[model samples]
Target: MTINFDKMFTFSQPGRRVFGFGTISRVGKEARSLAGGPRAQVITDSKLMELGLVEPVIEALKAAGLETEVWAGVAGEPTQGLIEECRKDIENFAPDVFVGFGGGSSIDVAKIVAGLMTNPKDLHDYFMKDLGVGRFENPSKPLLAVPTTAGTGAENTWLAITSLDDVEGKVGFADPKIIPPRALVDPGLTMALPPGITASTGIDALTHILEPYLNANTNPFTEALALQAVRIVPVFLPRAFKDGKEKEARFQMMMQATLGGLTLNYGGVSEGHLIGQMVGGRYHIPHGVSQGIALPYCLRYSLDIFPEGLANLANWWGIDISGLDIKEAGLELIKASVDLLKELGMPWNLRQIEGVNRDDLPEMASAIATQPYFITTAASCCRKINTEKDYLWILERMYEGNFLD
Candidate 1:
């Protein structure tokens, strides 16, 4: 970890608090002021309700003297209309505080709903580059994020990964207002996650940290969180996956995920996130699973284009390519990632997963190039993306059974 001296960039402070295991007892007092004015709308999915976690969150709100309404409609690839419908579900409540209590998708829905409380626009208006219908002049409502899965750092972030209309691509809607006022991380909440979910989301956390750590935009503050996530995910993910009942392991993974989410606030992300978004929107692959599949290749290819500060990266992640060329160092990181993905039972390449056809490759490549955040943030030292052809070349490799020659 690099020594970063900027005090304003510090992650842990007094007002922004975190209570680990058994902290559910404090939800009432902690949430009181935020939930005071109107009914508190709790945004969560039916799976969580079935799993019995919603009962605890509801009990906490009622204990806090907050009127609560349950919005549980989120399902399968949350669409723009779904967000609008979710906005409608709570439109009647006019709730003062929104509590997101599921995986990343529900939490993202909660963020969009909070934005719509004051800003009267649909998801289409907030697209980043094109089709800009909404301008984010107004602030978002107060929000509280309590994540169910161990990944999607949505709880700690202000960016919402929303689906776009007509394009079949995903774009982020970002603003400081989108950031939740508070994050409630209870590792106990993640203890019940099934193995497949545990792997995909855990990989998402890994990408969140890795991309920021690699991107040139990273600062010392976010770097700390990202690096810590990198160090901890390897150790705790396996423990949490093998035994969901491992309270300590689950708690640690949750905290680490919070750290990963917070990282985006400071370090931001690069191509890995953008490519993952493309694969996810087009193929219906889980967000983290697809990102994990492409990361090593992105690292290997992008490194050739940017050499500045990479030796430092090689040393930071403790890869052995230090004595060799920069490309070798990049390969070292990818090799380590490949080993970890296989161990966690995630797909290493597109062919490893079923149902995705070869015919879709061109459209998928174009979709990735269409959204340029990854290209822009590849590395501070990295140049503009070579061409549309360059993107297709990489996507063609993805069509193969192997990312490596």
Candidate 2:
């Protein structure tokens, strides 16, 4: 197998340390102090509110002498107009700080709004072609990212992924100015998660690790995060799902999720993320399920062309992968990945996503061609594929249902 030296490695430095528990008491205190103001705005979903997830956070802020306005309009994947709406609402509260208090989508929206509210220009001004508009030349307001789910690492990273009405995959544009001034992770927040959601988000973090590790630009630093994430999920994910109150399982999952986000801060994302986003948006698949569905197939397809990289990944997972020949090890990784998905109850084929069919493969493949991560991560030397064929091939295997030898 050949590895490209020029495209070999990328370096990344994480922005902040993580503090975790099951409560929101400390978040408000830290956020108010950091914002240096009395007014704090929270962005979260209605479902979280109904679950009483944000109550402790609100009370904490109130006790800390911080007035708050909760924006409960965020749901589904984030969009541009939603950001504008959030910007308008904050004016009423005149909040000096923004708190992202939910899952990846909610936190991502809050992160962008905080930056845009403080920075100049229209939200789209900094899009792909806008030369210098979105650059984080100056810091924005004090923003605190508190995760309700162990996902997206929005707490620890600067990248905000939002969907466009006209676009297919989530368009990601990152600026250092957008990184939250502080990130507070409390695993207690995830204690109420249903088994299905626990399975999906855990797998999503797993995918983030797998993606960066598989990128042609795989770095020694990223490799560590990816391997640890891989190791943690298989061991702790089931426990977290089986009993959401298990502090040990929940704590490690949160840390693993944060690590995955930090590791991918600069290192590239793989075809799995790119293709998963495509599959999710077009078919209404959730992010975590999309990650679980696309990742193993992507790794399996890339194995033959990148055997040396695959070996490194196998070693990172601490499997006795060397016992088999390189080619055999590569195939074993695919089997192991599929096994992980089954453990999580993830769907393997497009058909598993209600309403998906053979006819939809062309559209889905076409959609993946337009994904955002493709620009930064696609390897010119990686295996060239008739993506439509791969799309159909995966579905075929998925339809087979049980494990493939």
Candidate 3:
């Protein structure tokens, strides 16, 4: 198949990305620079605070003469209520800059809070207008993202995701203005993450790379980042999962996660993300966990449409599928993906996750079928999504753990 070099694509660059070990200590200086003053708000979850990650940032901010307010209330996938709760704090304290200081959930909450400060609208107001949300006229205050986990690349992307109480699935607020002005990603912050989170988030980052790499909207820049992440994740993720204290493995996983973010910004994602969002939103599954459950089958389902892209991914994993048909080659990639999940002791099927049932398949399928992602444009998505039945089929297979069959 011939490639389309003429395909037009846009990329969003993070303002100031400081990636390395021990860089969280620079949060104070970065916040001061962005805030143009000493007032800063640190948004994170109670878990990270309990793990002793939040204090260092607060202490560093104080050491830099910055007055800091701690909002460690983030929980689960951020919801409208969670965002509103944080919004109240932002409204009352009114800091000069906002620092999102933990994982994707924490960072996502901060993104909405920052936007709310300037937009003065409901969360639904910022939903993609196509989805009947309001429009964002002004950019939010200079928000800084400090991600603790290696997935959800929410730190670098323009999209903020939330689970709405009144809605059945996740909603994304896609606005260029929401992209953070700076990100301080330190691998040390992830060292203490348990193996379960490490594996799940690693798969999420990998899916971020995979979907965009297969997206019809892909460009050279996005493909480059996605390919690099593809080459790195399968190797480093296992190491990070087995031993969270492995610095080099943790560092590499962190880098790939950010690259995954960049890929989503430029190339966009396809079926897997759409389906994963449904499972995550309805089942209350973590984004990464749902990605782990959905990606293998999603990729296999799209193999015929994304042969070249999926074939290249197999090659990157060092599989020699030269003589095999695309289906065979794609199967090789599927086996590799599932093997990685097993090696990491992660659940490769929906059944493995507690509370999942076959009864939920129809609702999950309907949710994904209505997503903007399933409604493709002229050249946005590579796969031909048969939303009416294909989604239900995938969900059933996922529920049954029917990978090879």
Candidate 4:
């Protein structure tokens, strides 16, 4: 409900989106229209390759009469080294069009590689940091994202996240030129996702929606997309998790993820992502699981600041908030999110993640406080997180899994 009217904001998304069941068949046709030459490249992960998902995309590209190369090297979170490696492999191939055909990681690699191909800069220069000199001087090759998962919303957003191993943190390239001009979102592609992935990614999508919607830096356009996507998560996420073949559930979740990405483009994320990125980068936790663990705690931290927004969220989830004060209703919303995390079999505390310990909290808190991206985006959070102590307070609660307290 809170909007910053002092400064103007801009909203953007991919130029075109094709969604529905069996839309993968149209990738060939779409690629033909976007291609400047006969060469095309598909960036994805080896897991998807083993699962037999990458072949269909390659076949689609080849069917359109294009010479295609497959880079199935993307694994785990994208790193600066990985991006450079992918860039080296493809710089010589020089594809006129790119098909990012997997989860967020693969799509992110595709986006960064496409950008580097045209912009002649080290991947580190584009990192979202104080000293980062990333500026795309030329337009990137046309990219078409094909999201096989219903979580990351990477297919629709321009930002590409990468891990900085030496710093034990994550950063992104925030440039409009890196945004995919077209996307193919087919729920059918996610049919083979295991229950664990279904749950984690679904929770990841929820974090993306909640952070932007609840943040002070939001607009009518962002709120509408976020609200719609938020409603779908409670109803459909469980169904999709319980049965991966649930067609309607998968379809709705995929739609929610795409909309969540759109909200990120306009609204952006805040504290939850900041903490999640840091912990995930330091401990090698899965991105969605890290976000899922931090989401309710972050919401609770900001509850008093966004009572009306939280109350509205409770109503959307069909919770009866009659006769309750706005703060109480907000607490109910936070409890619901925690409950959903439990239902999805996600970790409820930071301690549950491997490589995380009580001693690491101070270092993690300090890293978040000093991180350039966090420092810039912290102003947009409903609750101010200005110092190491502020971050430590939240991190302590997260470590102990203390929700109400």
Candidate 5:
């Protein structure tokens, strides 16, 4: 790959990160250091609570001599109303620090709650509107993110995604102030994940890695992290998927997710995420599963315009492109990605998803084209999206699981 030193880009991540098999043990100590007082709240979901994952975290906080409260209400993709209800529910606690524990949705709820705790406005006030980005006037309460899933990279990113029923889509609140200051990534937390969750979240991490690497906003810092993550996913994701107790695979996947989070923070996601967000909110599909279904089709769309980047991805996937042209190499990469999804037992097409009828493609395409987030990502896409027709073209291929010819 050729270097482009003149291209300007920026990078940032959480102030502190502790990653290992037993890093969850240190959360209390880390929390104490970042907390302003003795009160700490853990934001998670009912499922995690039922799994007894939140107890250790609570015990850790109490062991650190902090007064802890658990609000286990976050479920599925967080909605605007859910955020409001969570903020209202925890209003009396007035936590000095927050621990976001669980998957992306839970962590995102924590972020929004923390960000809105001190600020006077509602979460909607800070949502990305059209081309203009919203800014948070006040810094959020100190937050520590502990991710159980190896996808979404919500722990490190400055954005919080929420679904809005009014828009029938998802929107994000983007601000540097809301990014978690500390993270404890313990792969041990994921050892009990079911195969389906493992497969979907693993593919989600790969999508996060690839979009940033392939987009126009990529820089040296993001490229290094993204490519390393790319290599890790193809090897270890399957191991982790087949055997959730594979410690080594789990550890590597945790690292890959964290790295992918950083890339996602700086380089940003493009077409796949744009489409994923749309379909995910509309059909209530798991975020990672939606991203998996969109991955290869979106890459095929990008391949027509930016073969060089996709070719590099093909090389990293261990494809022998010695005798192939750029297009051929890109196609091989797409094939490899699709094959990986199949191997992991992911849905190969939009039609395979429940409630996603063939007739819904046009409406979905229109919604995607006009969505502010999609508009923002379109600028970074390899191929210029000229109209709803462009999105429709990709949607059509995705519906049929058609390979690029």
Candidate 6:
């Protein structure tokens, strides 16, 4: 097995993590500790509010004597326009501490609001070139993130993702200053997620773990988290999907998802996230769904370049391949990935996405080729993708459900 022992890798100093049932009640005191008598803005979506999740946190904050205001307008995927609206509300609230109190979308918006409130810059100022306008260097306010769903690992990451309509894709802003000061992960919060959402979000967590684990740049720190996360998901995701009421499954998935986020923040992701973003950007497909569709094929494509990594992954899946060659072990890993996807009810190809067609592949492939992460991350994969033509080849295979080919 080849290891990049001499390669340099950067690891983020993660914030404090408080995990367990009923931890949501700690939000009030936690917020206050981060900022005394904090006037907090709780960024979330209307659906969460309707689900009766928002009121309890609001009440808890009020009980702790903190002034709390709820911004429940965030809907669908985040965009520059959506974030600007959130920033306006944050400025009015003048919060000393911010709380991201829902899924990835809500957390992403709150991260942006927290950063922009202190720095006062346009969203575009911080975005990488392929996704947005420019860069902004500044610190954001302290934030406490409470994730309601087990996906996106938004609570653990410093990167904030948003859509650019002009480019019809997702872009991100990354800096250490934007990492949340505290993360409250309560598995109880995820018990109400619909089966479809539970499956999609769980798969998204798997993607975050698996992509970076197989990347050429992966180091020991990332490998530890990724190995644990990958091991847990195949077992727990199906259990959680089968019954959201299962407390044990919910709890494990929550922890694994956060670990996946940590892996992405530290080691970075590869072609799965790259192509997933392209599809999501173009079709307005939900992020997790796109990731679910892209991951298996992306893994298959990595077989030759990352045989050792894939063989190890096969073992993680509990696939015994003691006497098999590297290629055989890698193939078993791909099959295990497919079986897991089937158990989760995730669509494994572009054909499954309603209203999508092969004709859409070229445009999506072209757009991803322009994104720098796709180029950089894929450079480390088995099949390096350097041009739109290369991305198109991959996309065509994805569109046709050609995992074996």
Question: Candidate 5, which ten residues in sequence have the lowest lDDT sum?
Answer: 126-135
- Model 4: per-residue lDDT, tens digit, 144-192? 9999999999988877787665544566777789889999999999999
lDDT of 5 by residue, 129-151 (tens): 66424457899999999999998
Prediction 6 global C-alpha lDDT? 0.81
Q: Which stretches of model 5 miss by more than 4 angstroms?
A: 2-6, 380-386
Tens-digit lDDT track for model 3 on 272-337?
Answer: 887787787767788888888898888777776777777777877888898988778888998998
Candidate 4 lDDT (Cα, 0 to 1): 0.84
Local error of candidate 3 at residue 324 (angstroms): 1.9
Local accuracy of candidate 2 as per-residue lDDT tens digits, 55-127: 8888888788888889988988888778788888776677788888899988888888777766667766666
- Candidate 4 off by > 4 Å: 131-133, 164-168, 380-385
Candidate 6 clashes: the total is 0
Give candidate 3's error at residue 337 in angstroms: 0.6
Model 2: colliding residue pairs: 22-188
- Tens-place lDDT per residue, model 6, 232-268, is 9889999999999999999999988888888887778
Question: In model 3, what is the error at residue 76, expressed in angstroms?
Answer: 0.5
Q: Which stretches of candidate 1 lie over 4 Å from their true place?
A: 1-15, 126-135, 306-325, 371-383
Q: For residues 1-405, what per-residue lDDT tens digits would candidate 1 score against the true structure?
A: 333245233233212656587665666566676764857888888887887878988998897888888999888656788888888777877988888878899988888888889887655566555532223658778778777788888877767766656644555566667778887777777777898888888888887776776655556665566556656787788888889999878888887777778777666777667666777766688887888887767666566655434444555656666368766665666677788888888888788778877777777666555554444334331234445566666666666734554
TM-score of each candidate?
0.88, 0.89, 0.94, 0.96, 0.96, 0.94
The true-versus-predicted C-alpha distance at residue 299 of model 1, in Å, is: 1.7
Q: How many residue pairs in model 5 have overlapping backbones?
A: 0
Model 4 poorest ten-residue lDDT run: 126-135
- Which residue pairs in candidate 3 collide? 125-134
* TM-score, candidate number 4: 0.96
Clashes of each: 0, 1, 1, 0, 0, 0
TM-score of 5: 0.96
